[model samples]
Target: MTSSIPSAVTVPSNNVVPSTSTTTEPSTSAEPVAVAVEDSSNLDNDLLDILGIDPTTDKKYGKDLHKDLSVRLQHWTTVGLDKDLKKELKDRYLTPGNCKLIDPPILNAEMKAAISDINVKRDKAIEAKQKVLTSAIVCLGEAITLLLPSKDKDTNLIKLLMDAIRIICECQHSD
Candidate 1:
């Protein structure tokens, strides 16, 4: 008696690959045990199935599907999840007579005001630094202009001034 194992396993239309193996048991009869392959060779189809996305007619299929899924997930998290949580909270904790919604507008406005103040301070600091840089540049330019025309000007002094200006300019004004 000879037994042959299939070289190429053909996956059916349903994307299930079944492999049968004979196992010897304590009882005289041998039984063929069937094992199923969950995923097929077609990786793209498998991935699409895993993501719960259907193939669309759109040219940008991957991008559109990704965007659609993102929107769906976002909506579920923000609205559906929040609604479920609120319902659970109401069911578990608060009664109808004692229930009062927290005023979020007051907290939101305070946060906005604080952020605006910080932004204003940041803008002011930037403007001050810019003014200082402008003043330094003007002073350097005036010193260079004056020294170039003077007959008694020291070369070493001019070189030192240039080096100072270069150092200052190299240190950028931004944070």
Candidate 2:
């Protein structure tokens, strides 16, 4: 009788690849396992630094910065020179009543007074600038009106043209 058995094939040791599978079992060793934990404090600091924010500063400093930025953005938006640009600025900088910093220092009386004085000056300057701009616009409109056709011949057309110009001037000043 002849017995049949398959011979085992052995790969060369250097050519053999380790199995990719893994098995999990309760650890038998008495030693404690070392766990890797992320330091959240460092992460917070990193985020603050990335955003150009200094959380350790006094509250007053942040408030002052916010106030100044608000004024500048408000002026730019009010000028209405570029609608898209103003919209972008408003979205980025004008979060109403939400400009608090992490830990801002309290402002001293002297500092508060200085800021108040500066704001007063800024308001006056803005008013003067607006007056000048309005004067220029009116002067230009008057010059253009002088060049238009006489109202006696083209009364209806002249009225329409004048109305359109007035609307434009009103729109510009209202902004």
Candidate 3:
């Protein structure tokens, strides 16, 4: 029984060749599982599957997966796994959103102001346009003219438009 027991050292199997590996399990304790190195591209699909994200939709696949996964992993306090593998996973998959590398401002007041200003300007323009549309009433493709800055009825673009409108209106009425 003692002779049957293999040592902790990995001995070559019966058909041993120089480059070929035929390592036997460590007989003393639980055999250390030999995990194969997976191709990163394949693992990316697996990670996306785990995250319930569609691969096809993420056109820039690697960057997209890294960004999304890193965000999700922030709240994950505990993960039980091998130390080296955990480090490797963190280093490889959760890279782009690495909080350590780029300290991003969390949507501060300046950003808010810029965004709000654009929205306000857009709204103002839209409101102005709506007023033009509502008040003008398109009277046979004619918008009612507004007064110019100098109140120049003789040489104003608005008066010219109004004149064009009057001519068009007259033609429409005559027809």
Candidate 4:
């Protein structure tokens, strides 16, 4: 006797069988999956600018900037910044000492007084520089205008004119 199997198998439409094998383990590919990461470095730069940090070759100043940034980040975080900002700051700067720094609030009266004193000193220095520059410009302009056309041929007057011209050229070049 010869036996043969059917070419196709069919099941009742209402009695379908589920697949016997199922995947239970997560993927283990070595390639890194892409994720959207929030950039906190730009926030660091903005904080530095807001705190009036100047570019310096001194390592001490760099340390000071880092300390100031850390303190400010802690203070702002405690004072209820936007949720996203707070998260970014915490991710970037939160530390045991940073938490303590904000406890007394950096914006207190003593800090305010110190900042005001620094501002006054800076303004005075700027005023002094401006006065010196203005005097120099006025002196050069007056000397140039006072020279007679006949004196233009004189070597001494020509030297003085050249000196004034040099000052003007230096200022332009500096700008």
TM-score of 3: 0.16
lDDT of 3 by residue, 24-101 (tens): 433343333323343446676668678686567777533344777776565443554466754554344331232222
For candidate 1, the per-residue lDDT at 26 reads 24
lDDT for each candidate structure: 0.51, 0.47, 0.43, 0.47
Count of clashes, each model: 0, 4, 0, 0
Question: Best-fitting candidate, measured by TM-score?
Answer: 1
Taking the tens digit of each residue's C-alpha lDDT, what string does model 2 give over 56-140? 6645632344778888878766774475753454344322233222112344667657787777566566544444344434444
1-175 per-residue lDDT for model 4 (tens digits)? 1112233233332332331224333324442222233343546877767867455633453234477788887886588467685455445433234223222112446655767777756656654444333444444544555665553456687576768757744653343
lDDT for 147 in candidate 3 is 42
TM-score of each: 0.30, 0.23, 0.16, 0.25
Rank the candidate models, highest lDDT first. Answer: 1, 4, 2, 3
Q: Against the true structure, candidate 4 has what lDDT?
A: 0.47
For model 1, the local distance difference test gives 0.51
In model 1, the Cα lDDT at residue 56 comes to: 67
Every model's Cα RMSD, please?
23.9, 22.9, 25.8, 26.0
How accurate locally is residue 75 in candidate 2, as Cα lDDT from 0 to 100? 78
Cα distance off (Å), candidate 4, residue 92: 57
Candidate 2: residue 172 lDDT (0-100): 42
